[model samples]
Target: MKPLERLGEAKTPDGTVLQLYRHDGAYLIRADGVELMSTRRHLSEDKLAEVACAPLVTKPKARVLIGGLGLGFTLREALRHLGPDAEVVVAELVAEVIQWNANPEYALSAEAMADPRVRIVHEDVSKVLRNNVGGFHAIMLDTDNGPEGMIMKENSRLYATRGIAATMAALKPEGTIAYWSVGDDPGFVRALENAGLEVKAMKVRAHATSGPFHTLYIAS
Candidate 1:
């Protein structure tokens, strides 16, 4: 068996360690010691984009905002679903993760990041949502273990009441927002409803054939 090799490491604002590793051709990103994302299972990430962007497939020049660049699968999948004229703005707080994905030697998301439709913003996703009022046709959140902050303590603000309001305000009248989670959270669903959104929660597999179930929350 090939050994797991640590490729890169960085420190979060709270000083927790973020590390990237490769084993048997698969890449994984972990916060502290918890796995955040992995190239081995990304079906749920793909579904997050598919479900969020489906309504905008035929809408010309649609704009989408994605929180977190994790492995770039969500961005790549969003690009695949949307038309050429559409735009995708990715807000990634960790600059090192962007560098890792853009590193061709890592064979992660370099190609996806280069897609003409993608605009990378090296900033907090909350700030991006706050600044872009009524800007995006779709917003996808696959950040920090979903609705809770596993990597950064500040990330929980994205799912807070004020954050949900800001997120809803940043969307067009009919725009949709999708969230990816490791498990179901009824409280999060209620928060979306309190923000006046109709929420739909779907259980998705981590991989196409078989893997642990994950949750995809779609709100509009």
Candidate 2:
């Protein structure tokens, strides 16, 4: 087996340590000392886009906002599901995460990033959500480990009442927003409802049909 290689490191806006590592030909990202995401287990990430865009796939000129580039699995999946005229805007907090996906040696999301329909923005996703009003047909968020397990302390706001309200305003009428979490968060679900969006919680496996399960909060 190949030993894990440290690809690079970056700091979040709040100065939290974010590191990238490669092991067994797969990539992983860690915040502080906790493993945040890995290339080997991205099925749920793909599902995030698929489930959110299912209703909008036939809509003409559908537009989607993806929070957190991660390895671009969600972005790539969104591109595949939407039509050629569709647009995908990805807001990544850390620029290094975007660079890692563009790295050819990694072959993670190089092609996805180059797609004409896709746009990359180096900014906090919460700001993107707050600034846009009815701009997107769908929004997918996987920026942190739910509302409670925040990699960056500031991210807590995104899952709070005000943040949920901001996201609700950013979406078109009946637009869907899907949030990926490492575990179930009932309080966040209630917050989404209080924000005036219907919500459903789903349990998705970390790897297709195996591994631990993760929660997905789909709201509209």
Candidate 3:
């Protein structure tokens, strides 16, 4: 069997190490020795985009914001769902992650990044949400490991009440937001409901047929 090779790494705002790895044909990213995401199992990520952008498939000139760019699966799935006239703004905090996807040797997201309708922003998603009031027809948040902060300490705020509020404000009146979580986070659901959003928690597999169940929270 081939051994896993460390490709590259970067540091988070809290000084946590984010490492990228490859084994066989799969890519994996770890935060402080914990698995953050992998190309081998990204059905949940694809679902996050499908649920968030499905409503806007026919909406002309629709705009959407994606909070993370894990292997660009969500972005690719979103581009597949939205119309050609729609625009997708991806806000990724870690520059290395973006770089890894752009590097042809890694073969990650270079094609998705080249999409004319897609715009890449190298900034924290929280700040993006704060600045874009009613700016997106849909919002997708797949940062950190669910509502908990695994990659960066500051990412927790993206799931907090304040962060949820910012997402609400950033969305158009009929817009929807989807959150990807590694597990069920009941408390986070309460916070979304408290914000007056009708929440739908969908259990999705990490892989298409089988894998640990991940939660996809759709709120509007």
Best by lDDT: 3
RMSD of each: 1.0, 1.0, 1.0
- State the lDDT of candidate 3 residue by residue for 160-196, as single tens digits: 8899999999999899999999898899999999999
- Runs of candidate 2 exceeding 4 Å displacement: none
* C-alpha lDDT of all candidate models, in order: 0.91, 0.89, 0.92
Error of model 1, residue 152, in angstroms: 2.3
Model 3 clashing residue pairs (backbone): none
Q: All candidates' TM-scores?
A: 0.97, 0.97, 0.97
User: Which is the better candidate, 2 or 3, if ranked by lDDT?
Assistant: 3
C-alpha-based local distance difference test score of model 3: 0.92
Q: What lDDT tens digits, residue by residue, belong to model 1 across residues 1-220?
A: 7999999998877787899999999999989889888999999999999999887889999999999998999999999899999999999988899999999998798998888999999999999998999999999999888875356787888888998999999999888999998898999999999878999999999999988999999998
Error of 1 at 195 (Å): 1.5
Q: How close is candidate 1 to the true structure, as a TM-score?
A: 0.97
